[model samples]
Target: MATKRPRRQAVSTCPCGLAETYEGCCGRFHRDEAAAPTAEALMRSRYSAFVRRDEPYLLRTWHPRTRPGRLDLDPGMRWTGLEILATTDGTPFHTTGTVTFRASFRGGTLHERSRFERVDGAWVYVDGDFPAA
Candidate 1:
């Protein structure tokens, strides 16, 4: 009979480049313990979700109009870090906003300007545009 090996506990850090632990940062959003207060927060949580491969969270936070029927994550690609470059109008009072960031992975960096909108008082990712090479 084969025995199940014990799962190792991995050290957690916020993939969004926040100075807090994963649980204190993006983990709360992933577990539905809290809603992101701003568009930037939502973006951070979404990036963290990509790193953790939390497909459900990503789908939940994505706007219905832009969300795909399913998500396909690249298993061989490892996310390394995130750098928020700039944000515009993503405040608590704004209905729409944009976030420009650089998400570094194993191969290279993905630079994008993502658009967001508040749906029913909750920020949701709408879409994004990659910078021209």
Candidate 2:
């Protein structure tokens, strides 16, 4: 019997340990065509956005009703890693979804469960609850 080869996670390309290209992984969400399959994907893409300093894309993906008036990333803060615990949907094809993640920051760490909604053929981040740091 032949054994299947193990899949490799891309360490160089993605901040997350997924054996996929940046373009194939989080970049898809930034692009207009591809839709995230789950909340984890969305969360990963969002993390990548922070790394890439793509605030515009962040705003684009954010749910407008709950979106802040402006987007600003801390200048000195360095994002270390991302750990997604669970997800609901958060895909382009879904109506509603949730993503729970632990993101490491320089000042401290952030653990949040973000909610997303798809309305009128667009996916947007709605809200999130964070644990006390």
Give me the displacement of residue 66 in model 2, in angstroms: 1.3
lDDT of 2 by residue, 91-125 (tens): 65567888888888777788998887776666567
User: Each model's TM-score, in the order given?
Assistant: 0.90, 0.78
**Model 1 Cα RMSD, 1 decimal:** 5.6
What digit string (tens of lDDT, one per residue) describes model 1 on residues 1-110? 99999998877678899888999999999999999999999999999999999999999999999999999998887999999999999999899999999999998999
The true-versus-predicted C-alpha distance at residue 31 of model 2, in Å, is 3.5
* Best-fitting candidate, scored by TM-score: 1
C-alpha lDDT of candidate 1 relative to the true structure: 0.94
Write down the TM-score for model 2.
Answer: 0.78
Candidate 1 positional error at 78, Å: 0.2
Candidate 2: 10-residue stretch with minimal lDDT: 10-19
